[model samples]
Target: MRFSTGLAAASVLMLASAAWAQEAAPVVASVSAPASEWRAVAAENLLVIDTDKGRVLVELAPEVAPGHVERIRLLAGRGFFDNLLWHRVIDHFMAQTGDPLGSGEGQSPYPDLKAEFTFRRDSQTPFTAVAAPAGSVVGFLRSLPVQSQPDALMAKMEGGRVSAWGLYCPGVAGMARDDAPDSANSQFFLMRQPYPSLEKRYTIWGRVVSGLDVVRALKFSPNPDGIVTGPDRMTRVRVASDLPEAERPAVQVLDTNSARFRALADAARQAKGADFSVCDIDLPVQVAGAPAA
Candidate 1:
């Protein structure tokens, strides 16, 4: 709706900051926005989430998690992760879901955000990175994959400069919260593996430029090892403003805000940190202006 509370969790340092994870919270998004309102940022440069299987492109870094990509593009253009499911398959690592109340604590009528840790890739991200190691809030976008920290610390306490929100992996999406950091609301996840304690806590924004094998074929529901049991139905979730605006799908997000993503993070930190394996890092995509595929 109209959304309240207002961005940055109403400041005052969101409760003087520090302290997080109340754990056990996913009821499937519907908190009802009020942590100070903000969520709504996708003028359209490519978002398309359409999942029944073949289409998972999510390149909305908006210069690094601009308020968690404008609150998941105003809640995935409103359909709010339609149907929501993909629960929590692990396999190679990653394939969570946006939990429209799969009960991961992800419910969000609104109001939750207040983490978005880092950003500083620049010129409004264009592409390239992959050196990986990051964790002050992450860095690296194509050489090995990972970003955020362009001007974080909440844009230096809401002063200016943005771009930086890469932390999770695999299909890397975000929202799901509870231990604090404003409590997320729309429970979300998608990182085949490599947590590193969820660098910058959690709120990753977007990734998976293409259909990571239908999110690695999703189908794991045991949880407890980490707490993500799902899949009842989700034969849906098609966003991109509900496609068909000539079949909306034009993409191009590799820019960690770009300078060739720090020269591919210096060729992925001088090559060979075991030669990459977070599914071989690949948030690279290209559908072009008129719906190419």
Candidate 2:
């Protein structure tokens, strides 16, 4: 399903058109809340990618995929992503980059990472339920939407806790792998739309908390496999932590643990009903330069 800003994705089941077609207001309003309900984007977990179109700010998900996140930090810190072309960009699918070869064949000198498709959820995990329509529970682990088994069944599992994985929502970033699940290396992709098919199949390690329009504005390759000729290059990529203090992007995301977030989730549930998918709602974010008062 495609979940774009302020619009339901094509894959999302449409409810009564008459009712939902005009219900965008509630969803938009829910995006704004008290400043107290928000938190700053830690420099250690932020990625800033500059392209010709614009800058794309990604919030790394270390808790979900620590190894992959560390790889991103290590690579970016060393200027490995500079001038890397977005070699593969499928329309309405995702834009893949980080391949030094610019032909989907090259990767960094780093060794291939084992697939981190899912992570263990424990009591310390700050997951807030947005919906529980079926046996599965849909919620937020910070800014990422996740679907997992119910709590009752979690304790009986081998890990004695529920298994949760990030949904392949728009603006989500994932590793690009070969046929083998463990072949992912330096290559990665940013989703242009929500694709449930990729769930549990790719390693979701971060999300674009801002500049999604810039992501959409990216030029796609004419080729069917998303290989662009003279593709736009990432002028520079850097982990915020490595940047000078004055130059860092001090971002803030809506705290899922806040009452405001729960209210928004409730409003969304009321708006979509059985048709509601967690991807339908994009997490709200702001920069430190102009935080909500």
Candidate 3:
């Protein structure tokens, strides 16, 4: 199903402010982190989508939405997403696809997935906080931005863990469903900009580590329904691990837990002042030895 129509106006306003902030903020010099501070993304968890626009690389977060990740992996491996049209797209919002029928109503023969809007996070979870406001802590878990209850509350919970959910930052990937919370099937969307209102209401499975510009360049529909007359299609989709070794792209992300990352986050917070948000920070990514887009 489509997102709540009420969000469209709010999204436009938010996008305007975000654009202004991006233009006004001083550019921070790229940090040179130690090699130890760089972590290579697992090939199996990296999704490569070659669209008519360009190549988009997404780093899947199974820890947050295992079921959805598995579904994506299975379908991509089976080439189910190949040539699937991006049927619905909204500027400064998101692009929706993954329907084999090229219409919003289709799905894989597999069953619909249950909602995974929240996950339990314990001390073992790799979380690096950028901001702690009152009762909630906002941070990054790998490449995905997240918000969760304070770590102190974990001890009070039954399983020594607290509930956490992914933030709908720009480039976030989320499964789309009908009004029913558990109706998510094959369709999903890639965020074009930040929209915090979707937090905890949708299951976030991954975040784009590279080529977000390509996502933003997708042709958007002028129709209020977001249905495109002629849409761009996914030429091919595959898990990095499934590709031949020589063809696979080597990807590395700046570790969020590293001191260099903390310094970068601090710089961003200071620059944005009260308007600061974890989404304002774009983690550094390095890609090497990949076939040309």
Candidate 4:
């Protein structure tokens, strides 16, 4: 099954309806938080993609989409994703790749994965709410923007939890599927802009913590199909844990639960007023020991 861009317009409308005033807020160069306010990303959860253009580092969220994360880790570890063409790239939207055929109609040998549109969030989940609307809470689940049912509803549910889904913010990574709900295999896309309509439709497994500019810089097609001629390709893709000690990149993200993050969120809310969204916050990330883009 192919990843389709037919609903691009509808996606924009849905985001607008949700009062998302602007694109993702630009990430600040640095944040002045104490060492304790920062948390290191585990090597196993880091997906490193070195494209012809640059290196893109994504922080995989296994808690949000465990199966999809496993698929990515498996593929990357086996060198299945290396040298795959980014055949489809939409301007201000996303870049799609991981098809061996270099066309949309391709997939890994593995069976299609069950859709993981949303996940259950219990009291043990690491959610730091930034805003509470009428019924839902918008927050961060370890750097990924998310919206979930209020914590109060957890007591009323049979599982003692509520549902939470990742927001389609810029730099977020989502699995691509066909018309079928569970058709996702190996093809995926890195979002270049926010599109809320995809929030519960596609499975989001991670978010790009570094080299977002490289994602946006991908070649996009003027044609409505977004199929590029002579498109860029991923030179190499590997999980950080698989790389040697000196080759592994280290990443640290500002803890959303920290007071510094709260101040940052407050400033953003004050600036955007009623139009603020959790997607508007770009959590600070620090990357070290990675190859230069």
Candidate 5:
């Protein structure tokens, strides 16, 4: 599903202004707690996409979109994404790639994936609530910001569990599907800004933990059809676990259960005020063994 919102575009400015008020150093220091306060990105789930523009590191979320994540892993392991162009990019919106043919209509020979837009949230899920107002709960399932319906609705659901899904915030990765919701295959897109209209329509499989600017810096299509004649291509894509030990990039994220994350979430809530959306906050990520900045 493809969606854009003028209101969300305006909301981006509000989030930007709030972010501008807080310096990176203090936040970094606060989030740099003990080793227990950080969760290392699993090697198998780490997606390393080296594009002509720069490298983009994505941490897959199997808990949220299992099928999509599995497909991404399959494609990357087979090198299906190598030399794939960012065929469609809209300024301040999103950067799309993963089509080997460099056209939006292309896909792998692999079978199409069914939509995994939302999943049943179980009690075992490690969701830390950041906001609970009335009937909804907004929280972090690790680094991903998610929203779930009220727990009271669980009994009405098929599995007696409430539904949850990741928000389409900046740096979030979503599968690009055709009009038929289940037509998604190899193509995907990364959000350059928050897009609420796309919240429940598209499946969010992973997130760009770092290098969001790299996504924003990609060459964009000038025409309305979102077709780029010659765009920066993803030269190579690999799962970190598949790489040799020396070539693997180690990454860690601030633990959501830690005081640091709570403090940051509170600060963001305070910063955005009346216009606060969960998208205003970004989970801090630390990278080593490679130049992330």
Candidate 6:
């Protein structure tokens, strides 16, 4: 679906009230932790994806790609992500989404970010990197798991500027676009599979933090034109705090800049990828406070 910059999307579910209306039940519901609880924390290192199945927590990278994190948070706060759908899926490659139009030919009101190619290659970039077999089809770059497509790799490697980028791993979330970098407005993609050609070429922004099963459950439909398909309808998307008593994604994001988070990152470094990828990185989240269902 294309981003309708002018509108505000709120959280909603698709229950047929007429068919399922029942007596008032004790509705213990899930809700996102209040932003007021966040206390103006940094962006990277903490992200949450509230999906129908459950909440997917993601650690963002504001230290590296600060602009994108700011813009994305702004949009999400304004309820921009509501009702969108993942549109393109390529088996063993990537699952793409973020077209507000549901047509894979749309964008948001925001401008494209200036490419953050490399941020000095900080192995300690707070990304929970994984170990990839050296001979595997795709491998990890200093813990940044790669999709390993030759073309995409070449593109990313061509410009070795010290810019930052989001590594495309299973469940890695990023922006999708036409050939031009400036064209990437709202469309995005997720790596259900891997595609290395993307490397530093596209706007590598964020990764999936949790609930990959919900992503896995998305349909693999391709359009006649190819390179796209609409994902399940996003009935509504609002910041967890904005949701009603019963319908918010339940989870708490670990403070990315917290001392505890730094400790966890260091611990992960010593740990091997028990089949972990960039998407496997867990940004901390927990169900907080009372339930509103």
Off by over 4 Å in 3: 1-28
User: In model 5, which residue pairs have backbone atoms overlapping below 3 Å?
Assistant: none
TM-score for each prediction? 0.28, 0.87, 0.92, 0.93, 0.87, 0.56
Check candidate 3 and list the clashing pairs: none
lDDT of 6 at 217: 68
Tens-place lDDT digits, model 4, residues 47-153: 99999999999999999999999999999999999999999887767899999999899999999999999999999998999999999999999989999999999
TM-score between model 1 and native: 0.28
Which window of ten consecutive residues has the lowest lDDT sum in model 5? 20-29
Q: Write the per-residue lDDT of candidate 1 for residues 1-293, one digit (tens) a residue.
A: 11112222222232232222112111121222232231222326346665555566665555556776776767767777777876544443345566665544446677777776555555344433333345433444432245544333444544444455555544666555655566665656655444434556666766666665666665654432333444534444445655667776655434444444344444543443544433333433445443323
lDDT of 5 by residue, 111-148 (tens): 98999999879777878888886789998787788999
**Candidate 4 vs. truth: CA RMSD?**
2.5
Clashes of 3: 0
Position 266, candidate 6: lDDT: 48
Q: What is the lDDT of residue 163 in candidate 2?
A: 85
Encode model 2's per-residue lDDT on 132-213: one tens digit a residue. Answer: 7678888888778888887778668886778889988778999888767788889888987767677887899999998888
After superposing candidate 6, which stretches have Cα over 4 Å from the reference?
1-46, 52-54, 121-165, 222-230, 238-293
Name the TM-score of candidate 6: 0.56
Question: Cα deviation in Å at residue 193, candidate 3?
Answer: 0.4
Candidate 1, position 57, lDDT: 64
Assess the local accuracy of residue 48 in candidate 4 as a C-alpha lDDT between 0 and 100: 96
lDDT of 4 at 64: 96
In terms of TM-score, the best-performing candidate is: 4
Off by over 4 Å in 5: 1-30, 152-160, 290-293
RMSD (CA, Å), each prediction: 18.5, 6.1, 2.5, 2.5, 4.6, 12.4
